[model samples]
Target: MKILVSGGTGLLGQGFLRVLREKGEHEVRCLVRRTSPVERLEGLELAYGDAGDAGSMVRALRGTNAFVHVAGVQYTPEVLEAMRRAGLERLVIVSSTSAHSRFEFRSAPRLVNEALLPGSGLRWTVVRPSMIYGSELDHNMHKLLRFLDRSPVFPLFGSGENLWQPVYYEDLARGLYAALTKPGTDGQIYDLPGPRPLTYLDLVRTAADTLDKKARIVRIPAEPVRRALLVAERIGLPMPVSSEQVLRLREDKAYPYEKARRELGYTPRAFKEGIALEAGRLREIGLVR
Candidate 1:
């Protein structure tokens, strides 16, 4: 089976491609733009196209039987049309745990797309990954690792009590691969999270422990900081984070992956183990000395 993958050079995309190459079962090709860097994905065939455009996706969809779409859920309509036009039957699209968040504006489109997939008359599976992290390129845990490595103090927002279960990149990629290959996964939505959820403070301490850093955990009030970030963004002032991000830190991001486990055999590594690997990778790239 020949599968076309969008965002094949991205973080999760790279991990998924690595899995496909290791298994060596199906023919895999990456649908990338002409200007995309083709350095890391050396052996895979490249289909130059844009996921945002239906016509471009159609062009890239030529001869591909299935798709591992890592593009945003907002483009599902375009992808559906393009896949139908190209006669592609199978689709495995990535969504986020944020879709389930209380933030309606951020989650609406994703919810709509999840609703749109089941009735589309296609074999579709929605895999919602929670806080993907593995290397510095993850832009999540590695940033914290970098910060912990550099600073002696960790200014945590809120009470640092909201729960989160972040899945490793390779684990998430494997889950996607499972959904792509497993027979009963069609029309199903799977949440791929870590082995267990931990408090934000626990997360910080875990990373801090891994780094063996004696960083001071200072708890700053979240409301005032959120308002300040809002004003800063409105005034074109620079802030490390946005207001929405600040607000979301208070949300409990933990979700059970039992369905993924039962159906896809998904078993994520522990957060400590995952973060340790991330720390090692950051060290490799000289991001965290």
Candidate 2:
């Protein structure tokens, strides 16, 4: 079997490529931009293109048996068209668990983007991973680790009671590969979360513990922060944090990956263990001082 992967240079996609290489069962091609750090994807076949451009996607997707999309899901229409043109049927899209986000402005798009697919004559499976973390390349946990490394103060936007479950990056990538290879997965939506959920306060403590640093957690009142961010947005002032983000921090992101586990064999490691591994990796890479 041959597979075409987009977003192959990022941490999750790179992890997927590692699995593909280890299995050595299928031929793979990566759709990438010239600006993409193709260095990370060394020794893989490359198709120079961006998913936003329908023509290029069509070109790159030609002759591929399946597609695994790790890029933005908002590009769904373009990729579907390309798949249709290429006569490809299998698709595994790496959507975020934030598709269930409390903010309408955000969640609506994720829901709407993938809704266009039922009648498209495709076997599409969506994997919504929750707060993916594992390596230094990760966005969420990596930033937290770095911030904790530099500063003793870690701010809590809310009461820090809201739950969060961050899946390891490799776990998500492995499940994504499973989604592509497993049968009976057509038109299924899987939520891939960590082994267990922890409170937001516990999250900071866990990261600080793994990094072997004492953290000073300061809880900033959520209402005031939200109002300030809203005012900033209304006045066209650039703010580091947005009202949506603040509000989202108040929402619990705990989800169960039982479906993925039952179907895709996706058994994720605990956040405690995962974060320690990430910290160790950062130290080895000289990212942690």
Candidate 3:
């Protein structure tokens, strides 16, 4: 199979490419922007193009059997039309669980992009995954790891009890590969999440323990953090925390993985186990001791 992958330079996209290469069953070509970092895609065939550029997109999609899109944003109409012109048969788009959540930071735009898939004259599957972790380039759990490593104390937003299911990038990569080859996934939407859910505090505690750190967790009110972040955004200050980040911490992000497990044979590692592996990677990169 000849597959074209957009966002091939992203963490998840890189993971997917690695998986495909390991399998050695398909010819994988990835779309890389001119300004994209190519370090992660050392041995892969890259087609220089932007998704928004119709000519580039068409050029990239030509002669590809299918495409797996892991780009962290929505697909454009021109790209979809280009897929048709290129005679692409199927598409595997990686959306997020954020699209189903109440927060509007990234979800709203994702839904708008998802709305374009159906009746678009192509076989498409939308995989909505939970928090993606593992790997060196992961911003989600790596940020937490950095904070736990550098600070004597970690901040726990709210009661720090809201449930979260973070899927490892490797597991998500397998799921995407399955979605690409699976037969009945056309026009299907599956939640590709982790095997188990952990509380916010427990998640932090696990990260600390994995790194052999004994940092005290400090609980702070969500409202105050949100207000402070809002104020910082209004002014000329930089704040890592956003209102949506504070709000999401208070809500449960757990989702059922039964559909993906049944259809794609998606099996995710336990949260603690996955983080421990990530800790090892961090040590190799000198991100942690």
Candidate 2 vs candidate 3: the lDDT winner is: 2
Q: What is the lDDT of residue 209 in candidate 1?
A: 88
Candidate 3 contains a number of clashing pairs equal to 0
Q: Report the C-alpha lDDT of model 2 over 1-289, residue by residue, as the tens digit.
A: 8999998888889889988998898999999998998889889899999989988988998888999998889899999999988889999888788888878886888888878778788999998888888765788898899899999688878799999999898887788888888888999999988988899889999999998899898878999989988998999999888898888877888887778899999888888988999898889988887
- Which has the better TM-score: candidate 1, or candidate 3? 1
- Separate clash counts for every candidate: 0, 0, 0
**Model 1 misses residue 167 by how many Å?**
0.7
**Candidate 1: Cα lDDT at 124:** 95
Task: Quote each prediction's TM-score.
Answer: 0.97, 0.96, 0.94
Rank by lDDT, descending?
1, 2, 3
lDDT of each: 0.89, 0.88, 0.85
Residues 1-289 of candidate 1 have per-residue lDDT tens digits of: 9999998878899999989999999998888988888887898888888888899899888988899899777889999999899988899999988788888977887899888897789999999988899853588898888899999889988998899998999999999999999999999999998899999999999998898887699889999999989999999998888999988888899898789999999999999999999888878878887
Give the CA lDDT, 0 to 100, for residue 288 in model 3.
Answer: 85
What is candidate 1's CA lDDT for residue 195?
92
Candidate 3 C-alpha lDDT tens digits along 150-194 = 999876779988989999999999998888888899999888888
Residue 202 lDDT, candidate 1, scale 0-100: 93
**Residue 54 of model 2, lDDT score:** 82
Off by over 4 Å in 3: 104-106
